[model samples]
Target: MRGLFEGGRICEEFSAGYYGVCAVGGLISAGTTHLAITPFDVLKVHMQVNPVKYNSISTCFTTLLREQGPSAFWRGRGGKFFGYGIQGACRFGLYEYFKKVYSNLLVDQNRSTIFFLSSASAEVIANVALSPFEAVKVRVQAQPWFAKGLIDGFPKLYASEGLFGFYRGLVPLWGRNLPFSMIMFSTFEHSVNFLYRNVIQRRKEDCSKAQQLGVTCLAGYAAGSVGSIISNPADNIVASLYNRKASSLTLAVKKIGLMNLFTRSLSIRIMLVGPVVTLQWLFYDTIKVLSGLPTSGDDRTDVEQIRTT
Candidate 1:
């Protein structure tokens, strides 16, 4: 178990220790958090698709409970759990790898540039990995009759739309996620830096475990709120595409119109994303600790080295 956790034994030259720990942490944290919030996802999707029917979060919750029973909220949770698990692994692992690479290449190694470039790259990879499952998840969420879970959705989607169907919403998914990721990672990095140095009066690495966890959650929430606002339009379009089985991006945009896309259900989404992101970071950092690895924000030594070099 320790050997597996170390990850170095398997791949000695690949920053195995860092990659291994982060991959495991990211996978477990994101997958579990995503699944845990499956109910909110169901509400958010229904509300997004049919605002008149759902209206507000409280109403949406009760409506679903009354119509579909408690289990309905968890209808497609399995897809989210496994889908986000892969997405998280790629996101965190590749972000770190790219950051290090960019650090070595850039003469100044500015944190902002590294954060943006690395995160953008990571988001692209993560979204591609998440696309198929996302298609299924959205279908199930938008129309509860679509499929029961991952097992049913996969084959059903394949039979109906074939291979391309699984990736039907890939473009919108990328459009929605790219900015969100860019905003999220850059915001999270800077937020942690600000809170630790200015607010907490301690460097990130110098903080105690509880302090680190608190900082992670705060930074994650900040990132999630901003990211949600910036990406909500594309998010709306993506949901519509899946729910309506629409293909043309232009038509989707035309049908939704600009104002409707951003205005409908924005607050509910922000509320949903904020705590979900906070919990993901909290769980991710906790996993790091249990695995005997450094927390995500504790990169002072690396930053100093980059500055000197």
Candidate 2:
């Protein structure tokens, strides 16, 4: 296993093979972590779709347990795994690709702007792959009678609403994900830089693996928490639209209310998203290190050269 990963190191930086390795790492990181938290996702959907029924976190758990049994928590595992797996591949891989592309095009411009543009561009494509699975996942989790999982949910959704159904939430999905990705990537990059420069007072390469991964986790959590809050309203609207709580974005906002859209199920989301994002960065960087590559957000020298040129 170690040898297999180290083989990936032969790929030159920003090369196709390098991006492929990053994509595979992202697939494993996002798929597994998101799948692991299926229960929380189920609860979060329920809380957003029917806050009166699912109320508090504890209450939601008990109600789901009593009404639907333990299996209810894992309702959308199939969609969560496959959907996010593909999304992760595109997101992480393309972010790196576009980051380099943008750096070259916008030479000597703000690095933060590059970060924002790269992440935003990657997410636009990623969400297209994610929207259908998300549609099925939300439906399966929120409406138990809809279908068992992605296998059935896909066909059922298609049969009822055709291909359009799967993509109906694309706009809101983009709305939720674009800002989230921008914040996540830029914040993680800047946070990692800050930790190394101000707190650690050492070069990232000088830090031990454990210390470096610790920075990744802390930065990821900060990024996730902040992004979750900023994108919470759109997240709620996506949930509401998918579950038939609202027919359109306008109605979803009107029905869910502006305040509830931002606040509803937010704490649970932070709890869920914070660790998920942290683990994603941890797993992503761990794979890179194991593959003899440096962790992300550590290419200041190359970036500086690009900017100056």
The most accurate candidate by TM-score is 2
- Residues 1-309, model 2: lDDT tens digits: 122354656577788888998999999999999999999999999999989988899999999999999999999999999999999999999999999999999998888999999999999999999999999999999999999998899999999999999988899999999999999999989898888766776777667778878998999999898899989999999998888887898999999887898899999999999999999999998888887777788547544444454
Candidate 1 per-residue C-alpha lDDT over 242-297 given as tens digits, one digit per residue, 9 for 90 to 100: 88735678888887778978887798788888888888888887876666555665
C-alpha lDDT score of every prediction, in listed order: 0.81, 0.89
Model 1 TM-score, 2 decimals: 0.89
Best-fitting candidate, scored by lDDT = 2
C-alpha RMSD in Å of predicted model 1 compared with the true structure: 4.0
Instruction: Report the Cα RMSD per candidate.
Output: 4.0, 3.3
Worst 10 residues of 2 by lDDT: 1-10
Give candidate 1's total backbone clashes. Answer: 0
